[model samples]
Target: MEWWGVLEGLLLVLVLAALPLVLFALRRRWLARSGSLVECSLRISTRSSRSGTPGAGWALGVARYSGDELQWFRVFSLAFRPRLRVTRRGTTVLQTRPPEAAEVPMLYRDQRIVVLADSEGRQIDLAMETSSITGLLSWLEAAPPETRYPV
Candidate 1:
């Protein structure tokens, strides 16, 4: 093959490798500008864990609050849709505390961990900024007078 052919092949490979990254960036930007989003780390448990510590694997994501629901989208993903949708009705905060020594290194600086459980009994652990947590709690508590959501 000629040198020009090899160069062209390399360029094609490079573009193919970068296309996904470019798409991910574009999706992230769109989600950011969409509004009412907070950058948060989430740890979702399919089943209950015996030990009472946040899962070591926390997925970094942005959460957008829709009417009575919070949608979580993974940061490194190209999917524009939310990976997890949490309803505000009957959601309760289980625990709130500072990150443990091991968790501190994995989490962003000055972030607090809040464990919450939905009506379905699924536990969601989220690490977020103080203001974001306050906003979330406010939203949870903002339900109609007849609806009761324990914060």
Candidate 2:
């Protein structure tokens, strides 16, 4: 009976520790499901920073949206009147799409884009210029089907 109690306690602790991880994984899965398919590459032209600038000078981002629900959320968030551009590479976005300026508790001109992975360390970076709609569409139209699907 004592052993049973000990096992039960251990199980409880294990479950408690795992709950957050499970929730996190589920959230990521939900986001991925909501993300749009990356069909092709876009030519990204960003504001030209001074020559020899180390960081991403100019770039735009394409928010990936897979469904209407998320799409509405995107529009709703933007209503707050904050102009959010994509963060540069190595940056992290809390959510895939930009939020409303009014909705955001605090506003930072530069945004962070989150990266999900399975590794010891995690990464969050400012969103960088991804590609342009015209360029992406062109690439998508040209690329073979095998290359377009996400892995």
**What are the Cα lDDT values of the candidates?**
0.84, 0.34
RMSD in Å for all candidates: 2.0, 15.8
Question: What would the per-residue lDDT of candidate 1 be over residues 56-97, giving only the tens digit for each residue?
Answer: 878888899888789999887888889999987778898888
Best of the candidates, lDDT:
1
TM-score of 1: 0.88
After TM-score superposition, what is the CA distance of residue 54 in candidate 2 from its true location, in Å? 12
Lowest summed lDDT across 10 adjacent residues in model 2 is found at: 67-76
**Can you write out model 2's per-residue Cα lDDT over 1-151, one digit (the tens) per residue?**
8899999999999999998777656644554575542221112223342234323332332344322111111211213221232212222222333423432333234443322211222332223223423332343334354343222
Highest TM-score among the candidates is held by which one? 1
Q: What TM-score would every model get versus the actual structure?
A: 0.88, 0.32
For candidate 1, the per-residue lDDT at 68 reads: 77
Model 1: weakest 10-residue lDDT segment is: 46-55
